[model samples]
Target chain A: MIRDITIGQYLPGNSVLHRLDARMKAVLTFFFIIVIFLCKNFWSLGLMIAFTLLFTAISKVPLRMMLKSLKPIFVILIFTAVLNIFYTDGGRELFGFWKLSVTDKGLYTAGFMVIRIICLITGSSLLTYTTTPTLLTDAIERLLSPLKVFKIQVNTLAMMMTLALRFIPTLIEETDRIMNAQKARGADLESGGFIKRAKALIPILIPLFVSAFRRAYELAFAMECRCYRGGEGRTRMKQMKLKARDLGAAFLVAALFCGVFFLNYRFKALI
Target chain B: MNENIIEFNNVSFAYDSEIVNAPAVVKNVTLSIKRGSFVAVLGHNGSGKSTLAKLCNAILVPQTGKVTVNGMDTADNGLTFDIRRTVGMVFQNPDNQIVATVVEDDVAFGPENLGVEPKEIRRRVDEALKSVGMYDYRLFEPHKLSGGQKQRVAIAGITAMQTECIVLDEPTAMLDPRGRLEVMETVKRLNRELGITVVFITHFMNEATQADRVLVMDDGGIILDGTPKEVFSHKEIIIDAGLDLPAAAEFSDMLISDGFNLPDGILTAEECIEAIYAEAKKRGVC
Candidate 1:
């Protein structure tokens, strides 16, 4: 059941989007979020939505999995929509009650908020679904390399991120194994009151923590054995290069940004 | 470039530096591992065999005398990296050692750390993976691999570094029977084909039988060191070292004690079988 949580999971593929340099994808994803928020009307949002869907289709990410990524934020989406409807009061009142009212503007704003949230989740999900976790770490490290000028240990931080990402599934599997072993020995982990359940987890958590620390020590030793000395003077095996496709994608994003800016201005002038 | 890849000059080490009176984990160990030789270190748990492996790579610098690898003293701070690169160490836990998610990337890790060129690293990664018979699974996640395959990948990680020697501290300890065989065969092939010096630290007597030389440790010191035949011949010392003999040796000992003719220091099942067959033929039972 824990494995079904695929929000941050990468589905391996050879699609053009998947092959894009991770740094390019990361930068575009950031700018894409900005474009999503810069819109003031349905026209710009529609453009962004179309762009997301087209990219999603080209990337070959399963639409079902993409929707699953939005499941956790579904409640927040509704909350935002409800909050906008109840709080915002503006042009063309549609209905009214004591201390509460719904207006045409409120309805429009609520719908716009929902669409924005959906676009945000889907756009970011596309990034993860296309790029492997290691590539993502490399992309983040490369993008954040400028912080080195501020005396930041960018390489160390990036190496830590890469290790963390590499170990997530491993730790998850370990946790699952521990849970099963505890359950087989008559540990009541599933059936209990809240406090009782939390207490039952102690048996699993203790060993898990102990093993995790041991693993950390062993991994550190192994890393040292491989001559890893603080990542100084280290060269990367996989180098990220910006290719023609990345430039084309960047060009498309720039055009989208310009379109959103124009539409946001044009719509405001009319309003 | 030295014929002797690793040398320990009266080395002593301990885990807790605060305990000055505590016995060292590796006590006054003096040894040299020749280049392109397969040497097995045998001892039960807590016999300081693992500590010996660590000392070779400078992971745990000896507290007393000096340990050197490829003529670089492990005690020298700046030489630590070079020592490690010259003598790679693979631990028992496969999952803990593999740093990268992808097999090929993990294999490239050591070379990358050593500052190899990207293209050369790629070539080495592929070559290492192919050597370990995991080339087809290069892009696969490490966690998804079998225990044996994961250990192979770890070995590949060392191989790609172009290390002259690899110290496997019970690499097959966590593996199943098949996994153990797979890892053992891989290590042997690496030694025989590539002429990479191998220091296989294991408690398994059968494993020790395969090595060119076996060293038995007890109480943090080497008690016996010789070829498999010479080492297994002294049954009392092996038992005193907290180790059992290979099954063939024990069986041969039993047969000889039962007034049957059998060769001493039998180290393999096939050898035992052949001895039994010859005895039967001599008695006209065949």
Candidate 2:
């Protein structure tokens, strides 16, 4: 059951985005989201769509995967469009049925909102899809190092993230092993109602929790033996270094934001 | 004995149910293993060899009596970490003990956790990997490695910690023939070339032949302890414990039963061949 959920999991490829510093990608994504929120009207929305499409193409991520990520949000998207279209009573009232009144302005907002949301999901998924979670967390730590002035333990957080990522596959593999073991003992996990199914998970859950604790204890001991005291003077094999292209990426995103923000004020004010 | 690296005295451990005595999992076991020696402990599935290995480094403290390593009591909570470092453990399932995704990282994990300097860790990690001949696979993910390579990496992990002795519990249980051979060869190399005290727990009698001393356990207690030849000579004791003698040992015994006066205490294929040749020389049959 855990194996099929591959939404934010990275797909390895030789793409420019994949090669970019993790810190840069994270910062750019934040600014892009801001730009997305400020977008208004057809030209701005079209620009956002074109930019995201260009990102998707460059990431070399399969279109099928992006579509898969949008599957769970499909219901929310439909509801959002419907609510915005029918409930708004601004501009020209084009249709009226029962208590519902469709307006021209409402249509425009609804259309733009849907486009913005779709773009937002795709753009964010692109970040995770290109970079492995460990590198992503490392990038986050480097980016957040300034918070050390507040005495924040960035390395600790990064370590936690790395450990979590490292264990995801391990835990999934463990769960599968335990399920198979239980099934061998004639534990029927299938063909049960909600309560029975929930109860059946006990065998798997108890073992998983127990093993997780065991692993944690062993890891602690093992780490201590290796002289892992804490996040003090640790060096990494693959250092998270920024290149000229990283700065260029930030500048490019800044330009995109400026253009998007100006269009929002100018276009919306005239309208 | 150069030094008694491991000492167990009247140690008994039980799950502590209502039952009395209950044939303690490790019953009244008193034994001392010398440093820089390769010792193999053999038994069937329920013979408690694994329990003994765990007690060596205080993975599970004895319910009664004590286990001490190099004068440090395993029961000493303060020295527990030090004791664990002094004697590292490699379990049967390589998948269960690995903490890192990458091979070199997994090896470095031990020294890194021990709070060694980054440069020192890098040096030890490289040396440990080279010791096991796996330096080339430094960057590879552990899951991508073969069973033998994974086990080698696990050994490298302990080696990098600079543990003087390593307790390996059925380390080749999950491996194929080639993998099992690879692991056994690595264990022997670590014991002889590196002069690391090795306490190996295994079911395979052939693998146990490489050890300096062979200890057989049955019903949660040591049944026999001696040199491999002296230990394997007790065929009846081994068969009663539901474990077999090494094939070469068996072949030697078979020749003796067939009315050939082959000398006893044969422990390997080469030894059996040499024994047959000696008999042929006596009879001018060679």
TM for every model, in the order presented, reads 0.94, 0.82
Counted clashes in each candidate structure: 0, 11
Q: Write the per-residue lDDT of candidate 1 for residues A1-271, one digit (tens) a residue.
A: 6544332588979999999999999999999998888888888887888898989999999989899999999999999999998888666888899989998888889999999999999999999999987888889899999998998999999989878877887789889999999989999998879999999999999999998999999999999888888768899988888899999999989999998888777776212
Expressed as tens digits, the lDDT of each residue in B91-179 for candidate 2 is 88776667666688788777766667777878899999999889999987666677888889999999998999999989899999998
Task: State the lDDT at A261 in candidate 1.
Answer: 82
So what's the TM-score on candidate 1?
0.94
Best by lDDT: 1
lDDT of 2 by residue, A151-244 (tens): 9988788777766766776778789999999999999999789999999999999999999888777666545544455667555545567898
Error of 2 at B94 (Å): 1.8
Docking class of 2: acceptable
* Candidate 2 residue spans exceeding 4 A from truth: A1-8, A40-47, A137-238, A269-271, B1-4, B9-24, B27-30, B62-66, B119-123, B133-141, B144-146, B219-223, B274-286
What is the lDDT for B238 in model 1?
92
